[model samples]
Target: MHTGDVTARLAELLLGARCPGCGAPGMGACAACAAGLRRMQPFGVGGLPDGLPPVTAAGAYADTLRAVLLAAKERNALGLLPLLGGRLAAAVARLVLDAGGIPSLVLVPVPSASAQVAARGVDLTTSIARTAAARLRSAGLAVEVLRGLVLARRPEDQAGLTRIQRLANRAGAFRAVGPPPSGPVVVVDDIVTTGATLAEAVRACEVGDRQVIGAAVVAATMRGGGAR
Candidate 1:
């Protein structure tokens, strides 16, 4: 195992498993916190960027979901992976059913920057995508995860950028790492903020002639009148 993995495991063992949402000691999220996360809803980008594929989120990025995502992404709260991944799987299932129930689909996660991954010791979105793929396979759907996208260059941090600024900054920021899949490609992401990153991902896949059906995300931030 990598030193980082060993350290994370050691920390988990020492700290014991506590709910990221409630801090209650147990395995993974507590029942009450899990119940709160059960409220999955479809969301759309309000000021949807051009070239962005149709995207649907499983739930709003707030409350317990927000806490859990932050814990998983920023704090190395690995226990929340299963719950978040299950939510992503549910979203992918819905999208497949809406698209006439394809027998199989390829899921491509939006890649994180190399520097960020080095610092975090894990690629949060990719890890969740893998877990989501496993859940989908268990449910009898043929799911394939393609790590096809990579950062063409590191862009500025997107913490507080406006939609237009984000779009400009992320333009041409991603490129496909290999030949794109022939079947439908669904970009999976942890969050859809301004839809810029997902839009760039779709563009990268299309560069290799991949048919991007849509995108699936764990959560989305509601803006304007709310997601459609």
Candidate 2:
């Protein structure tokens, strides 16, 4: 294990973990909550942004999954990384394999602003992408995480924003950095709400001739069955 990984595990152990889903003590997420989270079916969100890749999510953003994501992103609950990452990996695997399985693929995580990373004490999306890459590798699929997209400028947080507001805020907000990944790319994010962020990410990647196969997320907010 890397030194950082070892240190993080030690920290989680010393902190006396609590299950984010049910507030049960003694584990980051208890087995029951884990099982509940695993009861996920991949689905797409309504009103997807224009040019957004076909997206898939491990589950709906509700109940145990929502709680776990909140704890992981808002509270620095690093212990939840493995569980969340595993779900993300599974979602991505399904997307790629259903398309006939590539020999290797790249995961492009949506970038978080520097301010957000500082406030959270971690780059949440990148960390999850790294973990998800590891899980995919272990499952015998070659995977690489290419952080090729960067924010052109920091924008206001998406919280409380309507769909149009979000689309406006995120449009033209990302740019490709350095050489783009050479293989099929799957944009990864922690959540897919209106998909404005992922759409921008896909746009940025495509700017460099990178072929984005699809997108994957840990969860998606429920919406009407058809395009809104």
Candidate 3:
């Protein structure tokens, strides 16, 4: 097969011709699913999940948005990158423009715990952040991604934990891998559940005189497990 043919076949195999939202089998989510996903209003700084900074979510973490995020983060749905990536970039842009107050910005993704990375075989949050940063750069914005943060100590997953519980679990968990960057740094993540993880990450990023600009995420759990 020619290169173009091979590429097309790969796209078909990866993205399929159906929608993930409705199982209609044509380029993933169908029009209804797409519309449902869009109904999730993008929200700004409020009660965010742990290990993040002042954050924004593209939509509530339910229904189509939840499905898309799980598919991307757990099921290895690389095809959804363009969709989720666009949202992530939009969140980053909003933070940089409003909360961070920095013209040129740097994106720093909160490092997934080592065990989680080993399980997934990919850093989903970091991947999304890199994609988002590229989109920002394409729009003539100065942006760079620096994966210079890591969990100082491994901890339990915050899945069922309360916000306070999550906060305690993630407190003092992150540390810089080296001297941090000079430009404003926005901590990026895939979701905000209880604002605990994001808070811990913000504290770590702000340590050592590094200016933590803000936080951004693709989604946030809404009205679930006490998420505001």
Candidate 4:
């Protein structure tokens, strides 16, 4: 088969018959969508779970950006890593600067449930966290990807769950492992809906006195009025 034919078939297998970012037929993540993922406007999130560090989203989860994120996350569009990772790095940069003279950043990704990982055959959040860390390092920031957090217990899926239900579902979902981090920590996730998961991550890290400076996400849902 021709290269374009192979690509189109791949897109069909992974993300239907059209581009996720624009629904363009016979394409897998069009170039225009890749370019659209570059800009990131970090903003503070509100209504966080208590004891959760302040969180920032690279951008609102809407329009082309949402499509791009879902493309990379759900549809296995690995080619969009630089564009998506660049935006995540921007959010992490803002957190580091706001934190003031933080020598290095330790990124702890919110762990995926074992079942989910098995079903997907890939750990998407961890990949994004690593990508974000690399981007930060390229921009002259001290960065480390710490797989410090793990899922303590399987919880019901957050989809269709109410805000309170989400908070309860993730209350004890995460725990920190390995030696205590010597420096500050920043939890990273692909998306934040009600901030419950991020909060759980913060609480897990703090169980051992590790200072969680902040959290960063690729995008956040505006319906909860969290990301401003």
Best by lDDT: 2
Over 4 Å off in model 3, which ranges?
1-18, 30-41, 48-53, 224-228
Given candidate 2, what's the lDDT at residue 208? 73
Query: What is the Cα-based lDDT of residue 228 in candidate 4?
Result: 13
Give the alpha carbon lDDT tens digit for every residue of 1-228 in model 2: 876555545655787556789866555787789987777766654568666667888888888999999999888888899899988988898787678878899999999988889998888888998998999999899899988888898777888888888878888999988876778999999998877788788888899788999999988887642111
| Model 1, residue 155: C-alpha shift (Å) | 0.8
lDDT of 1 at 160: 80
Model 4 has a clash total of: 0
Off by over 4 Å in 2: 1-17, 225-228
Expressed as tens digits, the lDDT of each residue in 137-187 for candidate 4 is: 887878988889888888887888877888898888888889987778998
Q: Considering TM-score, which of the candidate structures 2 and 3 is the better prediction for this target? A: 2
Q: TM-score winner among the candidates?
A: 2
Ranking the candidates on TM-score from highest down gives: 2, 1, 4, 3
Instruction: Provide the global lDDT of candidate 4 against the true structure.
Output: 0.79
Residues 155-184, model 3: lDDT tens digits = 786777777787888878898777868788
Please give the lDDT score at residue 128 for candidate 1: 89
lDDT of 1 by residue, 96-186 (tens): 8777788888999999988778988888888889999999999999889999998888889888888888888888999998876867899
TM-score of each: 0.87, 0.88, 0.82, 0.86
* Candidate 4, pairs of clashing residues: none
Badly placed stretches (over 4 Å) of model 1 are 1-17, 43-46, 225-228
RMSD of each: 5.8, 5.3, 4.5, 3.6
